[model samples]
Target: MNDRESKSKILWTLFKSMFMLSACTFGGGFVIVSLMKKKFVEELNWIEEEEMLDITAITQSSPGPLPVNASVIIGYRMCGITGSIVAVLGTIIPPMVIISIISLFYTEFRTNKYIAIALQVMRAGVAAVIFDVVIKLAQNVLKTKRALYISMMIVAFIATYLFGVSAMLIILVCLGIGIIDLIINLKRIERSAE
Candidate 1:
């Protein structure tokens, strides 16, 4: 295809992929994130696994909803601002429409035994997906083999799970550490060059 045609094709594919993933994903952003990694990093080869991990970290630490945050970054990485807009629309539309419909029939849905049972069952699946994502993230962190990174991961988990510390606090602490590590690495590089 020509340049214009190829760009159009990519945009279309991006929209379609996001829409389908959003429509099918039931649990939340974390669940969808793993699926996105598979689709974008593994299948499409559009994004690197390391980049996806970074995206996951960024989206988790950001203010808004995780899926929307991820959509913005991933879309921007792929096709700039237009891609971000398209991705966000695709990500939001399905949940918005579904929730609207659910609200309309809220009473009926709440009263229905089968729907309740189905939702309860879905929670188990969601837990599994979340667990898988956790394992993958931990593996990535471990691969770095940096004592500080590994220790921070364990400490953060302990602080969150055991102490019930605020996630925002943990994220901020991690960000500070990351910045220090970056600076240290830069200094080391400078010294080596000199």
Candidate 2:
């Protein structure tokens, strides 16, 4: 672990980290997530790797955008509500500013020949970045070495990909299974004490 950083230092680090992560990454939430993990978990050593993975999962399962969700969770974990507010602002401001500028010239941007080509190239890059996120997520899951999780992962994949089942259903089913597992473990612990 690194030496304890002061409150102001931590807040500044959180803001700068999120700003840089959000500003430069073009592919989207997943790309931002990958970069965030590298900076916060790997480089800065601010967050634990497993906790980072948990944050990723939570962000994915939440309603809003993953990067925003992650920033809020991580910031709160590190420095409480104030940190969360700052981190969220950092993440939001850049994209908001960029979109506002782009929207000003939306018609011209849409009609321009070179812009269309650049958009096509960006799409390809985004695809690659998404693929990288998938592989990284799978590796994290595999590291857990839990058969139930792996089976659930495969079932979720097959359900969504092959049969075209709704992802919401799969998520609900997994939620039920997790709750049941918790109940069963609690019962077993009680029976052992008796």
The TM-score of candidate 1 is 0.97
User: In candidate 2, what are the lDDT values of residues 144-191, reduced to their tens digit?
Assistant: 798977888888889999999986788788878878978988999999
Candidate 1: misplaced stretches above 4 Å?
A: none
Q: Candidate 1 deviates by what RMSD?
A: 0.9
lDDT of 1 by residue, 30-137 (tens): 999999999899999999999999999999999998889999999999889999999999899999999999999999999999999999999999999999999999
- What lDDT would candidate 2 get against the real structure? 0.88
The backbone clash count of each candidate, in order, is 0, 0
Please report the candidate that would top lDDT against the real structure: 1
Error of 1 at 90 (Å): 0.8
After superposing candidate 2, which stretches have Cα over 4 Å from the reference? 1-5
